[model samples]
Target: MDVKRWLEGVQPRPATATFIAEALSRKAGVKFSLEDVGMGGVITPATLELGLEYTAAAPKVGSQLLGLTRRDLAEDPLAVEATVVPSAWTQPLLTWLLSRPEPLPAGNGIQVNVGDSDIRAVRMTTQLFMKLDFQFGGGHARAALAQYYVRDVSPLLEGKFTEAVGRELFSAAAEVAQLLGWTAYDLGRHGLAQRYMIQALRLAQAAGDRMLGGRLLGNMSHQANYLGSFQQSIQLARAAQEGSKGIASSTTMASFLAMEARAHAGNGDDRACSYAFREAEKIFDSRNIGDDPEWISYFDEAELAGEGAHCFRDLRKPLIAQEFAGHCLELTDPFYARTLSFIRLVQAATYVHQSEPCQAVALATEAIEIAGSLKSKRYLRYVSDLCTDLAEYRETHDVGRFLEMVATKYPAL
Candidate 1:
């Protein structure tokens, strides 16, 4: 019978439908219970064209559904043996299918089936983004993705997926959030960026993806370090290091450890900082440095060395920091302007710390020139540090000339 005819045939007793609904909700996945809507589900409102209002999500306890009576299902309201498929039915598939401009023609597809709270959300999330990555045509696409995929796709990764699947998915989702967080951070939306990174961390945890969690923590630590929260940054970075110990990507793991060292330097924990850096350096000695997870493949030896330089500068080891900094300066790409600018500022600071004020000013001047064309407040902050450090040198006309030029050149920095 049509839904209208079926509804008309079934009559409710003088009570609310609440009892049945609550029972059904509690037993949403059950089969053989009146709760098993897959037996013959139906919907109200007479508008839904989809088949079945609900489906069997799980076998009922003792093989019996709670709300249904065997007799008079079509003849009686309580026995109406028909299930009402929830509005949530196949919604995930429909959403996924629609998101694509060209879904595979009806032969076969790779869409993960939602099976009774058994879908591993993280793995599906990674696959969704990776499959579509071909659309971006990578010269250099930032890996930050929207929260829709994180929140929606995560539902697919809830249950007992394989360990490898969990690891891969969580790692990808975390990377997406980290990259997006970085962009948002660069754009100055501190609060929104924090939310995404934190959520990324939670998803990583759910997927048992410790390294992914570590990466998320590292992302947060970097932001904290930038904001001058040296103590907080160190704490977060330490947590990242601990979480990433056994992951496939030693290089990325090592970089996180190095970032922790940098934070410790900010906190003036020189011994702690040095030890961490040494540990990070040892990871590079492994033969398979290049065989890490794709998300962290960018953390080459040079990048680690550059970061080590920053850590050393924090530790007051000027000579070591400068050695690495000089190497990084030669190897860096122009597109990586912000990191290069940061390295330059640190070099200038190193000079200042060493009390070579003239050399400091010279190096700072050069850094300012490079920063002149960039639009990062972070870059400007470094320039301002140079100016502040050199405030005592206002005696010279060159200082006045420099300040005037800085005012014109970095007004928005």
Candidate 2:
């Protein structure tokens, strides 16, 4: 169980790997080995053993756990290609952790006073950043969050508090960490996003929040799909579905199903994608607002339409893509500027697929203009992809003008 030794043996070590090694080795006394642990490569319930058995009186980082195999410890752990959904081995562990009556202390050297009001303040501030991310872009809000997470929130985990307050505080911190992961994804920092996601999941587990954990898994699925890691995407999406089980609201399940549909579309399984999409729609239609969690309230019909647009676009159905994209545009709020820009980019790309360069140029022009007012790397990424596709039709006057405008206005896009 020489964790540091195993970590040092990794070839072409990732920065994430190094950080995990240093943090775990220094923060806790427990040691884990690949051969000694089950399901060690994943962030599962078995990982809880690391923090739960520490009785040496030294404080720890709440109860957030880290799980990685010996091989994962010795190689590139983030290689998510061909990754499969894990068996529900963590369920019993989750139950045990949730059944605990006492709140775990924070990591050694973390000394800060925390109260319920402090947790509420963090939640309110987090909501503001979340709104900014929805409207302005992740680039506008991520730096402030990164600093707050490290300097302000991290210490609060170890702060003195009653058990109820501690759990609530952990939950709040977990939500903020998830937002940080999302913003990182929006900023095109995929690797950093993955790390944040892993940490967020661990925090959720510590907080005994199953729905939040499922949402984080779903986010990972979304990122994997965008990166063309379709297998992992499906695996993660299904994992979200199964892990949440009785805990996830119907809308949340619909979101997970929608994500799985996108992964299936990426794999060219049209029938499977269609089936999942229909099932998602059915579940969404049956939603009861009172039973829904606030975290999943955003997955309404408009969001589902956006997913449909992406699915049809990937399936080479330009007409269907435009139909869904148009629906998304109609339902999207003007305040959701980033989402609107993204859907417009999809619509413009659909026009390109239809061989209508003039329409594509016009739509792309509007999307680029919207993006100009935002600081989202994700939005710019869509614009850049559209530019690459439009290059084929650059001989057309509209396309030519589009290219020139893009070069002039967004030189780095």
Candidate 1 — what's its lDDT? 0.54
How well does each candidate superpose onto the true structure, as a TM-score? 0.59, 0.76
- What does the lDDT read for residue 11 in candidate 2? 30
Residue pairs clashing, model 2 = 60-106, 60-107
For candidate 1, what is the total of clashing residue pairs? 21
Model 1 ranges with Cα > 4 A deviation: 1-171
Query: Deviation in angstroms for 224 in model 1?
Result: 2.3
The number of clashing residue pairs in each candidate reads 21, 2
RMSD of each: 16.0, 8.6
Consecutive 10-residue window with the lowest summed lDDT within model 2: 65-74
- Cα lDDT tens digits for candidate 1, 1-413: 44454356452322223345446667765423222333232223221111112222211110111111122122233222223222222332132222212111111114453332333444454444433332221111223234343334443333333445544444454555555455545545444445445545544554456666677778777877876778777767776776556663777778788888888888888888888888888976663855665556457766786887788887788888899888888887655556666788888778767866667666767776555455444566777877787677767676667767778876753
